[model samples]
Target: MATEIATLGGGCFWCTEAVFQQLNGVLEVESGYTGGQVANPSYEQICEGTTGHAEVARLTFDPAVVSYREILEVFFTIHDPTTLNRQGNDVGTQYRSVIYYHSPEQQETAKHVISEMANVWDAPIVTELSPAETFYKAENYHQNYFRQNPLQGYCAFVVAPKVSKFRKTFSDKLKQF
Candidate 1:
């Protein structure tokens, strides 16, 4: 299968990870930390917001099944991109809206999607666009957290809603499983 990568941070990685995992063509999704100055920032360090790191989702997908633009479309819809360094009650640099693109083509597509989706919100979109950086995988507990702890407080209240939104809005993009 032809695979491409898309790394994005829209609030907590748990939320974004859960959202993208349900999508078709998304072969894998890993929660990670990137777009930061720290070499290996811990979840606590990232939560501190001093490391300049964002909690991001590193996704492996097949472009032939779902284009990067379509991925951005889902990203833009589920999260509030206009608010800087925050999503819902989750506040900090690590919770910021960001797209860590792996290539120039992905960068261009990210910009185009953000521009096209600007009017969808009353405020201007503030999603960050940066070259993909060293991705330090989150601790094992953080991986597939939603699927692992679906009933956990945060997963049940926050992540589940986002996942539901994705499933409802993009039912056509979901895998048959």
Candidate 2:
């Protein structure tokens, strides 16, 4: 089966990872950092906002089952694309809304989706559309965080709400498992 990858950064990677993991045709969702200057930056370094990396998730999906536009549809729905370099209380360049497109087609689709989203939204979309950069896998503990620590404070407070919204909005796209 042919699969494609999509990397996106919109606030904490935990939130994005959790959301994408629930979708059908999504093969794997790994949380990480991308669009950064530093080489192999640690989570601490990226959080400091100097590394220029945005907290991102690398999602591999079966393109035949779900289109890239569908993935972007779920992405834009889950987070605030208008907030530059920030999502809720987490404020920094690393938390910025960004789409690191892997190909020319992905780039065009991303921009078109953003334009469509902009028409529905009154605020200017601040989501960055950049070419895909080196993707540094986050520390081992960061992967599948919500599934591991669903009861944790940040998971309950931040991630839960987003997951709830995603589940409600994209019920048809969710996998049974």
Go through the candidates in order and give each one's C-alpha lDDT. Answer: 0.93, 0.95
> Whole-model lDDT, candidate 2?
0.95
- Give the per-residue lDDT of model 1 (tens digit) for 17-126: 99899899999999999988889889989888999889999999999999999999999988999999999999888899999999999999988888888878899888
What TM-score does model 2 achieve against the real structure? 0.99
Candidate 2 C-alpha RMSD relative to the actual structure: 0.6
Candidate 1 lowest-lDDT run of ten: 111-120
User: How many clashes would you count in candidate 1?
Assistant: 0
**lDDT tens readout by residue for model 2, 1-177:** 889999999899999999999999999999999887889999999988998899999999999888999999999999999988899999999999999999999999998999999997789999999999999999999999999999999999999999999999999888996
Q: 4 in model 2: Cα distance from truth in Å?
A: 0.3
Candidate 1 local accuracy as lDDT?
0.93
